[model samples]
Target: MTTPKTNRKSGFPAVHLLEEIAQLLAEGPRTSNELVAITGYTKVTCCTRLKQLEASGQAYRVVAQASVTWYAGRKPAADTAAIIPRQPTVRDYPVIGRRDMLVQAFFGAPRECRA
Candidate 1:
C-alpha cells in the first residue's frame, strides 16, 4: 500500500508557523479565515498549521457557533489524550491572611475606589 501524505513540512515550517499562530491566539482566539488574513497564508495552509498545533497539544479549539471554530494556544499537555482547562471557581478566591490583614488593619478602611 502507498503511504499517506503526512502534514509535516521540512526546514522549520511548523516552528515558524506555530509561533506565529500562537502569538495570534495569545492576542485572542481566531478562526482559520482570520489566521489566513493575519498570516498571509492560503486557507489550506492555515488549516494545516492549525491541525498540527492541535495534534501537538499546543492549541485548542472552541466551537463558537454552528459552523465556526475559534482556536487559541494552550499550555502544552504532558501527555496528550486531551487537555481540560482548570475552570475558575469561588474556591480560587479564598481569603488571604497575615501581612494583608496587617496592612488592611493599619489602613483603618479601604481607600476610595478609582474611576
Candidate 2:
C-alpha cells in the first residue's frame, strides 16, 4: 500500500505564489503589470491572485483613470473617503443662456432670429 501524497513539496503552488505576491505588496503598492513582471506570472494569474487578496482583506486596489494599483492590508477609510465622488457644483455646468449667447456670438444668430 502506498502512503497518501502529503508533503510540503506537494503543496499547492498557487499558495506559494500568493505568499510571494503578499511579500511584494508589503514593500509598496504596485500595478498588476508590475506584479506580472516581478513574479513571472501571466497577467491573468496576477489579476486572479490580486482579486483573491482583495476578497480576503489582505490587499486592496486603487483605480485611477486607466490603471489599477494594488496595496497590501485592508483598505483604509481615508482611501475610501477620497474615492467617494464629490457632488457637482453649479460652476461645473455652464448656464444654458450663457452657452446660447456664446454660440450665437461665434456663429451668428440662427436664421429664425434674422429680421
Candidate 3:
C-alpha cells in the first residue's frame, strides 16, 4: 500500500490540512471523530492527519478509556494530555459580575472580545 503523504521532517499533514487540524486542537484535546466533524473531512482523512501529527510530534495520542483515545499538543505528553496549570473551561465564566471579571482577567474574555 502507498504511504500517506506527510512531511518527513515535520510529520505534519500538507499545509492546508495542518492548519485546519491545528485550529481544532488549539481549543484543547480532541478525538479523531471530533476532528472529522470539525474539518468536514472523512474518517480516513482525519485518521491520516492525526497519524501524521503524531509522527511529526505536533500532536500526541493517549487512551481515554478502553478502545477510546484523544489527541492533543502543547501538553507535557500527548498520551497524558492534561492542563499543566489546571485552568477553567471557557464555559465556566458567568454572565456579569465579580466571577465574570475574574474569568476575564484569567482567560481574557474569550477569543473574539480580546481582538
Candidate 4:
C-alpha cells in the first residue's frame, strides 16, 4: 500500500541499516555504545535499529551491563519484513529507556550505594 521507509535525513538506503547492523555483529557481540561509536548514529537510533534487526531474526542481544546491552546480528532473510522505527531516534528518553539510564550512566553508584 505504501513504499518502504528509509532514515529521515541521511536518505541512505534503509536496508543498509539492517545490513550494516548485522555485519557489525558478525564479528562478535557489541553494546549499543560500541555500535554507536562505530556507526556514528546516536545511541537512540542505533538501539532502535538493533531491536528491529533482532525482531526480524537478523540480530539478537548478547549481554547487558548497567543500562546498556550488547547485541549480535546476522544477515537478514531476503523475504524478511522491514518496519521503520515509530519515531526517529533523535529523541532523548528512549536511548536506554527513561526509567533510570541517566542515573545508571551518570551517577554509577545507586543512592543506596552512595550513602
Candidate 5:
C-alpha cells in the first residue's frame, strides 16, 4: 500500500492571492477591470479577491452610479480633510473675465481705427 502524494505548495491559496490584490490596492483605488488588466487575471477572479479583501477588512468598495471603485483600506469618511492643503494653481483662478484681458496684455491692445 502507498499513500497519495500531495502537490500543495502553500496552505492558503486565497490568502496568497488576496495579498497580491491588496498590494495593488495600496498603490491607489482601482476598478475590478483595472485589476484584471494589471494582474492578468479574469474578471471573476479579481472581483472574488476584492470581495475577500473587503471581508477581511484589508480593503473596501465604493459604489457609484456607473461603477465601483476599490480602495486598499478601511472606508474613508465622507468629509475627510486632506493632510496637506493644496497650493493654488493657474487653474484654480476663475476664468470668468480673464481670458480676453490676458490675451490683450500679452499681445498689446488691438489696433484702433485712425479717423
Candidate 6:
C-alpha cells in the first residue's frame, strides 16, 4: 500500500482534506483548533474549508465562546447569510451644515467685514 498523500509543509492529508474534515465533523461540531489538531492541517486551511462547507450548505457555524467559531455538519437557513449594509452616498451628507456655516462666518470674515 502506498502512503497517503499529505501536504509537505503542514503534514496534512492534502488530497483528502475535505474528506478528513467531514469525518471529523461526524463526531460533532469542532472548533478550528480542534480540526487543526485532529488532521494536522494548518489553522488557515481548516478555517478556510469550514467556511467553504458553511457556504456550500454542507456545514454551519456557531459561537462556542466569546468569538470562538465551531463548524458543524449542517446547512444554514436561506436568511442566515448576512445582509450587506447600505453604503452612504454623496446625498447622505450635505457639504456644509448650518452649524458649520455659522462657525465659519463667526470665525472667518472678509477683511472689510472684520472692521
Clashing pairs in 6: none
Note the Cα lDDT for every prediction shown: 0.67, 0.81, 0.66, 0.67, 0.75, 0.70
What is the per-residue lDDT of model 3 for residues 2-32, given as tens digits with 9 covering 90 to 100?
6666644445555477667866776777888
For model 4, what is the alpha-carbon lDDT of residue 61? 66
Angstrom error of the Cα, residue 12, model 5: value is 15
Clashing pairs in model 4, backbone N/Cα/C closer than 3 A = none
* Clash statistics: count for each candidate: 0, 0, 0, 0, 0, 0
Question: In model 4, what is the error at residue 79, expressed in angstroms?
Answer: 21
How accurate locally is residue 103 in candidate 2, as Cα lDDT from 0 to 100? 83
- lDDT, residue 100, model 5: 78
Pick by lDDT: which candidate is best? 2
**Worst window of 10 by summed lDDT in candidate 2:** 3-12
Q: How does residue 25 of candidate 1 score in lDDT?
A: 79
Winner by TM-score? 2
Worst 10 residues of 4 by lDDT: 76-85
What's the C-alpha lDDT at position 57 in model 2? Answer: 88
Once model 2 is optimally superposed onto the true structure by TM-score, how far is the C-alpha of residue 36 displaced, in angstroms? 0.3
Estimated TM-score per prediction?
0.47, 0.56, 0.47, 0.46, 0.52, 0.52
Q: Write the per-residue lDDT of candidate 4 for residues 11-36, one digit (tens) a residue.
A: 55555876777788888778788877
Tens-digit lDDT track of model 6 for 5-55: 787655756767986787778777777787888777778988888777777
For residues 1-115, write the lDDT of model 5, one tens digit per residue.
Answer: 9654322433334436668789989999999988877766568977998998888778989999999999988766622544556776656656454347888889977765589
Q: Is candidate 3 or candidate 5 better by lDDT?
A: 5
Query: What stretches of model 1 exceed 4 Å from their correct place?
Result: 1-15, 74-115
